[model samples]
Target: MLTKDGCKQLRDFTEKNYKETISEVAEGVWFVLGAGHSNAVFVETDFGIILIDTLDTLERGEKLLGIIRQNTGKEVKTIIYTHGHPDHRGGAGAFLESRPEIIAFEPKCAELEKADLLQDIQKLRGTRQFGYSLTDEEAVSQGIGVREGITHGERRAFVSPTTVYRQDTVTREIDGIQVEMVRLPGEAEDQIMIWFPQKEVLCCGDNYYGCFPNLYAIRGGQYRDIAQWIDSLDKIMSYPASCLLSGHTAAVLGHEEIKRTLGNFRNAFEYILIHALEGMNAGKSAEQLASELSLPPEYAELPYLVEHYGCVEWTIRAIYTAYLGWFDGNPTNLHPLSPGIHSKKMTALAGGAQNVWKTARKAMEEKEYQWCLELCDLLLSNDETACGEALLLKARALERIAEYETSANGRHYYLEYARELREKNKKG
Candidate 1:
C-alpha cells in the first residue's frame, strides 16, 4: 500500500511507461503484451495455433483469447506452459473451447498443491509486495510495471497440463511447428524454455524478462538456484534466436539485440554472485557485502537491468542465507533477547519515552527519517500510549523514503509498512 502522494507517483510512472499493446513479433507469432503483468504468445501452425502461457486470471485470459481470435482466428491445438507461476498458468481454462492439448515440463501438480498449502502466508506477503491490499486511491502498479487485474470468486481458470515432459529436453512436432522445450530450472522449479526450430523464436518464461528478475522474492519461497539460473541463461544465449518473447514485457527483435540483452542479463547476475561470494569468503557480513558490492557501469547502465523489482543487496543476502544458514557469525545474535525486551532496556537508557519521542520528532523535522524510525521504535517499545505518535512518525518516514526508491518492490515494502502503522493507529 502506498500513501496518496506515493501512489500518484507510481501511477504517473506507470501511465507513461507501462502501457501494454498487442504486436506481431514474427510472421505468424503474435504477442498479447502485458495482459496481466505477463504476456501470452500465440504461434500459428499448420495444425492450429499453439498458445503459450495463459496470463493471470480468467478475465485477462478471455481478453487474450478475444485478441487471438481477432488476429489469427486459428483454433488452439496445443497449449504450452513456461512455468508454474500463477501469472503464467492461472488462466489455462479460459481457452477451453478448442480443448487444446496442454504441455508442461514434468508436471508439478503435487508440488503445486504443497505450495498452495502455504498460500495463506504467501498471499499476505504478496499483497504487500504487489500493493494488492491497497485501497483504490492508494493502489498503483506492481514490479512488472502494470496495474494488476483484480480477480473474482475462485481461480477456476488454471487447468493442469495433459502432456508432461519428463526428460530434460524434449522436441515435438505440434501442428507442423517444430517445438523444442528444455527444462531450464531457474526462476521457478518447473520453468522451461520453448524454442521454435522453424521460426528461430525463443520463448523465455520469467527467467529472462525486461526488468532485473526476482532472484529472491520478498514473499519468502524456496531458494532459487542462482548458479543454475546463470547456467540456464547461458543455454538461452546459445540459441540463434531472431525473436525473443518473454513472460512479461514486449518482445525483443533482431538476433544481435537478443544476444546482447541476454548476455548483459547473465553478466549482471554473475557479477552479483561472484562479488557477493568473494566478500563472503573473506568473512564479511551480509550487510557489509551488500554495501560493498556494486555493479560495473556497463552492466548498471542497461535499461532492463534497472533495480525496479530485484535489488542486488537482497540477492546478496539470499545467497548468504542459502549457503550459510541464518547465523551470520555474530555471537551477540547467537542467543539474543526478544526485540521488545531489548528495545525496552534501550528506551530506559535513552532517558524516557518523552525524551525519545522528542528526539524522533526532531529527526523527522530534519528529514533524518531512518533515525526517526529508530527513535520511534525505542519509544513505542515500552510505552503503549506513545504508539499513536510513534506510528505516525514512522509512517511519514517510510512514505518519504519510498518516494525516492527506484525499485517498486522496495517502495511497496516501505509503503506497506506505513499502511500497517496507519491501520494500527486507526484500530487504537
Candidate 2:
C-alpha cells in the first residue's frame, strides 16, 4: 500500500506526463493518446480510413472508434497491426462490424500463435508487471504514457489477421494513401513501422516511446536482441519523417526534433551495450557491471531516457545474459544450495533468526533498505512461521524503497510485495 505522500507523487507524475488528448499529426493522420495502455493512429484516404495499432481492450477500441467517427464518418477499411502484442491488436473485434481487412507481419502471426500456447502464464505475469493488483489510490500510469484504460475491462475481442506480409518492406496504396510497412523489430521481434511518403509521417510501433526502451521486460519474454534493436533504431532514423507517432507516447511533430530524439535514444542503448560488453571482456560479473554502469550526464538528463519505465541497471544485466547465458562462469553457482537451505545457514551464521531480524531492523533504521531486505529474507526463509515480525519489517523497507523509486514498474513490484507481506502478517 502507498502512503499518502507516495500516492500523491505518483499521481502528480501521471498528471504532468500522461494527460489524454488527440492530435491531428498530419493532414489526415490523427494520433490518439490516453485511450488505452497503447496508442492508435487512423489515416483517412479517399476510400476509407487505415487504422494502425488498436488500443488494448474492446471497450477502449469502441471508444477509439467513436473518436474516429467524430472526425470523419469514413469507416475503417483496413486495420494494420504494428506488432503481435496483445495491446496492439487486442481490440480488432471492435472494428469487425466494418469488416476491415486485418493485416500483420508474417512472423507476427506466428508469434501470436506461439503466445496462445503460453497465454495463461503470460496473462498472469503481465498483470503483475502492469500493477493491476494495485488499488485505485496506489495505481498511477502504465509508465509508458497512458494513465487509465489498460485494466478497464478484460474482454479482449481479438480478431486474427486476414493478410500477412513476409517481405522486409511492403508498399501498398490503400485508397489514395501510399504507405510502406517496413520491418524493423525492436521491442517486439515482429514489430514494423508504417511510413507515409506523401504525408512524411511515420508510425513507429513500439520502437520508440517516451521513456527508455524496455530492453528486457521483467514480466518475462524471449531475450530481446540488443544489437537487432539498435539496428532497428538506425533504420527508423534513416527515414525523414516530419511527423513521428509511436505505440505508447505523444507524437513528435517536427523532423529535426524527431531526428534528435531518435538519435539520443539510439545512443543511450549503444552506450549501455558498449560498456556492458567492455566490462564482460574485462572479466566482470553481470552483477558487478550492473552496479558500476551509469548513463552519462548528456544521455541521463534527456526526458525520454529517464528510467521511468526501464532501468539502466536492469538493461546492463540483460545485456550480459543475452551475450552469455545464465552461468557467470562461476562453478559454485552451477550447483549451489537451494535458497531455503542457504537462508537457513545464513540465519544460523547470524546467531539466530531473531538476531537476523534485529540486524534487519537496525539496517532499516540506517536507511539501508536493500541490506535490510536481504536480512529479512534470510530470517523469513529460515522460519517464516516463527519470524512474523520480519515480514512487517520487510514490508516497511519495501514501502520506503518504493516511496522514492523512479521506475513505475519497480515501484509497483515493491509495493505489491509489501502489500502481500502485510496481508500475510495479518493472517500469521
* lDDT, candidates in the order shown: 0.79, 0.82
Candidate 1 lDDT by residue in tens digits, 1-428: 22335445445655655567888878898878766768889999876799998888888888888888899877888899998877778777788889999998873223534687898988778877776666544545675646555523335378989998888999888877888999988888888999997888999888886677789889888888899899999999899999988887668889899989988999999999988888888888898888878788898768787666777778889999998878878898899987788777787787767778778888889878778978877766665436587788889998887766666777777788899899999999
Candidate 2 lDDT by residue in tens digits, 185-244? 789878999999999999999999787767888777777877888899899888989999
Prediction 1 global C-alpha lDDT:
0.79
Regions of model 2 farther than 4 Å from truth: 1-11, 108-122, 147-150, 384-386, 425-428
Candidate 1 scores a C-alpha RMSD against the true structure in Å of: 3.1
TM-scores for every candidate against the unseen true structure: 0.91, 0.92
Error of 1 at 24 (Å): 1.7
Clash pairs for candidate 1? none
Count of clashes in candidate 2:
0
The per-residue C-alpha lDDT of model 2 at residue 363 equals 95
